[model samples]
Target: MRRKSKCVLGIEGTAWNLSAAIVDQSRVIASAESSYHPVEGGLHPRAAAQHHATHMEQVIHDVLAKGKKNNAKISAVAFSIGPGFGPCLRTVATAARALSLSMNVPLIGVNHCIAHIEIGRWLCNVADPVILYVSGANSQVLSYRNGKYRIFGETLDIGIGNALDKFGRYAGLQHPGGPKIEEIARKAKCYMPLPYVVKGMDFSFSGLTTAAKDALAHAPLEDVCHSFQETAFAMLVEVTERALAHTGKKDILLAGGVGANSRLMEMLNTMCQDRSAKFFAPDKAYMKDNGAMIAYTGLLMLESGAVLSVEDSAVRPNYRPDEVEVTWR
Candidate 1:
């Protein structure tokens, strides 16, 4: 199949934000993200979907306007279609399908988690690497094998980011508490011993978060924060190393929201260097969740011949990463 010569408009509404982008070949021409302030506790799916319904159009318009300035004609509209809030995903998907219909272009459906891994390829140029994806709703180590992306391991319960964010909230932090915990962890010199849970290639953060909360009764919050980062990162590093060893993959790429943690990145970088392996993380923009990654992956899928019809364009809140069958052109 000949590669299509075209640009893609990617829409992402997996959770917490509404993002849209126009990607031309190797670069993102323009993109816009509208972040929502989650309620006092955390993201309420219905509330997030409501927010998307209210704000996505403006974000789409803004991104489109910016893309138009660069003479970017959207040949397709790609959307993060599953493993997300149902309402939020529906909002974005509806917009994407409508736009594709109006423009008479292909409508591509992308796996949100796979988009993160592809972003690893885009930013790091690391081919066939072990991917550690830690985000609000997902935690998994992925690799491409046997013609599809496979999950070597994943969280047994809650995602690492959500565990950390919940801990932060328990400590009276604001919405999206991972960074706040990182900040507090940076100020502590003591290290509290926290549970490190890793079973084979999989991990569990809920137990550790619970233990950390209990420890706070006698341990300084800062010390607990520091310890949480240390232990949690170690769990990730250990599983990642195991995955690499199991697969004989020397390159490791980090993606998703938690991939932005400086401490985790530093530890992984050092470990990879010591092992003579490569480690890669995208800049802040790509490191955190965004639509550009989805759009870029759409282009790759387009070139590889990955397309979906309107009928099956429904959202799966608990979509598994490896379930997606890659049909590259």
Candidate 2:
């Protein structure tokens, strides 16, 4: 029999998605998400924040309703507290504060990046992995050491997702161009060369995106897509493999939104196979920013006595994973 565990209600609105979830140690009790689809280019910070504010009530209600049906009691309220759009983070932080107060439970502030890593670790059943965390705004190679997740490498300019979206927009594709790029690249017959920038432990994609924009003038769209993905994924994989070698860690965990790309996953898995190591990835739902990750990580923090007081609960727009002490671990 499972011992009864504390439940946490987590609110995530770091960017376009607004989500709420209740979870304990074993499983997600209930979770709900609402996403904003931009009409034109990339996400507008103010507009996304407004969308989160508009839908926050319904999203929270849905998860809270499900939690009630499951007889789940929320012991704390958790919120994503950084490395995100300022307006969106503030909006969600405000909501988390309200929820914590109304429910008379403790409030927990979660690092968005660490939440991704923790949830991936939980779902995939791996510990002490070299994490390849790729998302819209953040791309980092990290591993837990001593007291924190030490960053081994990161992008010098834009994240992989942003790079893909920029190239896709230039080619007249819609927002969130990663999936479309992957789909069209499957039909590509030949590969074209794009800039491959890697500086020691850091990689740069801004130049690659620029080169792809130029390639669109002569090369077929599918070819550009293929080349872009190949070059970029190779850069990421190269750095990730090096991190594993440096850390002597046998496990690799792919987290964040860009980790959902099948090609990226395949490339990382291939590298892991070559190294005779293991690779772990959570479901696509957990790959992106969501509430379950926050709640679950918060549960861990709560047990570790890492609670947040209402007076000191303020949003951090640029929280880094390495700045957090991994008390739960």
lDDT of each: 0.87, 0.94
- The alpha-carbon lDDT assigned to residue 172 of candidate 2 equals 92
Residue clash pairs of candidate 2? none
TM-score of each: 0.96, 0.99
Clashing pairs in 1: 304-328, 304-329, 305-328, 305-329
lDDT value for model 1: 0.87
Candidate 1 regions exceeding 4 Å error are 1-4
In candidate 1, position 270 carries an lDDT of: 90
User: Per-residue lDDT for 1-329 in model 1, tens only?
Assistant: 75545899999988987889999776889999898787688999889989998997899889999999988888888999888989888888999999989988888889899888887787778778999898987888888987788998999999999999889888888978899999999889788777888887889999999998898889888999999989988998888888888899999999999988899899999989988899988887887779998899888887777777888777677678789886651
The segments of candidate 2 whose C-alpha lies over 4 angstroms from its true place after superposition are none
Q: lDDT tens digits, residues 1-329, model 2?
A: 77899999988889989988999988999999899999999899999999999999899999999999999999999999887999999999999999989989999999999999999999999989999999999999999999899999999999999999999999999999999999999999999878899999999999999999999999999999999999999999999999999989999999999998999999999999999999899999999999999999999998898988878888888899999999997
- Model 1 weakest lDDT span, ten residues long: 320-329
In order, how many clashes per candidate?
A: 4, 0
